[model samples]
Target: MGFGHIPFDVSHALAGGMLLMSFVLLYQRRVPGLIAALATQGGLLGLAALWQGWAQGAAGLYLTGLIALVAKAVLIPWALSTLVRRLGMHGSVQTALGIGPSMIAGVGLAALALVVALPVAAGGSALAQEDLAVALSVVLLGMLVMIARRNAIGQVVGLMSMENGLILAAVGVQGLPLLIELSTAALLLVLALVAGVFLTGIRERFDSLDVAFLEDHRGERR
Candidate 1:
């Protein structure tokens, strides 16, 4: 409730940028495009952390912001780019819904998120409330993308987008300790590594990165 020390405009800008990027990500079909959008979101997250640190004078927040920048913004993107190039899997997966339908669904999902969160009124300030709403919307949208798209790469991107939303939610919560954040970062790394391994397995068996081929493997036998 205090928020006297925090820089409202800068933090809001950062959170807003990430929220906008989530919408942009939904429209991107190319692997490179998704990676770029994710990197942009990461940058915005770092900016938000920096603004929070400045406002609260919390050294941990500054470090968390830097971690988000270096790891999510830079390292993750670089690794994904390399993985795409190395695997030679640049094609986008065909979703069950057409692009138009996907866009409409995304709009609906965002609206649903806002509507659901409005009653709770969890945030102390307007910016936190906005960020929380937008972040949850992004998370749901990411899940939608994953479910609609049939491609493994698209699913991965969707998962990353969900992670971005999680980070946004974490930042919005007040008084969360830095240790939890650090542990979260560690867990994210482990998850990404596991995903990479799963990707390799998918590629090895199918000779392609498309999830459809692997998905129907069981059903096709009969």
Candidate 2:
């Protein structure tokens, strides 16, 4: 199955939805809203994977979709939400770059992604080129989210979102091995666990999840 076999419109719509969620993540200043956007993005990524499997006639991608739904959509969000409640951060406001400037930066990053990915994937099918471009945009936007946030949990969500973009790109590429897909899923799980531990430690040490506090502490020590 070739990339051209997949319907360009449908795949683009799903990828575009994920990209929209990335923007939502950036626009959110509340912790709960950020988590909800992350879950929504995950759901869209799962759908995109399932659609790709059907279009590309790849059974492996169905498993990839299932993994994405379970991990990204359900488990990760649930875990993060629970952790937030436990840490008494459910109502905490996330510190971030001003919404206007962040949005402008996001738009610029999206344009840069399209400019880079389109020419790099010029030899591929139109669907391939578009998906690659969108995936890169999602990745760059995720990085933007991380940079804009001062909350540790928000940074973790940004990291997971970046992984979602990688998975999106992998599913779009026909003939990607199942082993690679499985490994990527496993890596996300491990990352979540590690983030949880680190976040707990940070909270305990600083009495807040704001990373700026860590920087202040470091300066105090210095």
Candidate 3:
């Protein structure tokens, strides 16, 4: 079963929200603000999932929705807050490129994704295949943010954004399998735990978290 009332509208709105969050992520330079944005994006994802659950009457979806809300939305930010504190990071941001250029490129990317999506999607409901396009755009943009940024934290945020986009795409596919989500979540948590330990150890060894310094270390080794 699909969404009951406004399945088309609801799906498009969810896809649009994902795209909007992608744009927001492109320009965010502050760590805290970026984390906040991640949480906000996660909340929107939960809303989208909840809408799907209501429309489809799937009880399991509630678990997925809750995970999006509580784990991605709340727990991640809380963990980041604690991690940043331990690192004594007053303020850190990677500024290797101007924000203006990045925004322009991001817009171009969205346009490209939309254009490319049209031909492949034969035709169907309002968001039948367009949701896939939007999902792909968000994933690509998140990757760009991760690659272009000079901050470790920003890259982490970008990674999380990409993960959320993946989830959004799956949810739009009607009855996507569930076992993978639970398994992936467990692994992701472990990744975060390892990341936290690495962050602390890196700071202790190098006495800094700046990407430039880390690059220099790598250069010296080579």
Candidate 4:
């Protein structure tokens, strides 16, 4: 099977779902809710990978899908939730930007992604072009999530979400080595673990997970 055999609507829908989850991540004010949205986005990424695999008849992508589903959707969320509970960060998330502004920024970023990716991918199949556009949108929105939130956990979630976008883009592209996908998935898992440990240390030293406090600590050192 070729890219032409793939249903553009289904692939686009899955990618769009991940993009929508990025928006959801942007507006989420609670740690648990944000984690849930991240998991959902990861799940969508896994499904998109699986869909691409089946459509393209690539067996390696099946493993990629399984890794994404297990690592991103399951393990990462559970780890973040555990960290949140242990750190007693169940309250509303602190944000550097208001919900309205964050959402507006997300919309603008999505438009910018389309503007950049569509032309760049113009020579590709329609599905690939759409995937690239949505994937880029998701990445930008993830960055927005990180910038908008003051919590370290939220930043970690944003990072993970961005990785999801990268994975979607990789899966959309044909003949990408399975090893690269696996390595990317492993790197994301390691990053989440490191961020979790780093968050724990921040909480221990500063007695809070809000990254704004790091600036105050830096000022004190100065």
- Best-fitting candidate, scored by TM-score: 4
Candidate order by lDDT, highest to lowest? 2, 4, 1, 3
Model 4 has an lDDT value of: 0.88
Residue 218 alpha-carbon offset, candidate 4, angstroms = 3.1
For candidate 2, give the lDDT: 0.90
Candidate 4 deviant stretches above 4 angstroms: 1-6, 220-222
State each candidate's clash count.
0, 0, 0, 0
Candidate 2: regions farther than 4 A off: 1-6, 219-222
Question: How far off is residue 80 in model 3, in Å?
Answer: 0.9
Judge candidate 3 against the unseen true structure and give its global Cα lDDT, from 0 to 1: 0.77
- Please report how far candidate 2 places residue 117 from its true position, in Å: 0.7
Q: What TM-score, to 2 decimals, does candidate 2 have? A: 0.94
lDDT of each: 0.80, 0.90, 0.77, 0.88
Q: Indicate whether candidate 1 or candidate 2 has the larger lDDT.
A: 2
Clashes of 4: 0
Please give the lDDT score at residue 83 for candidate 3: 85
Per-residue lDDT over 96-199 for candidate 2, one digit per residue giving the tens place of the 0 to 100 score: 68889999999999999999999999998888898999999999999999999989988998999998898899889998899888888888899999999999
Q: Can you give the lDDT of residue 195 in candidate 1?
A: 79
Checking candidate 2 for backbone clashes, the offending pairs are none
Best-fitting candidate, measured by lDDT? 2
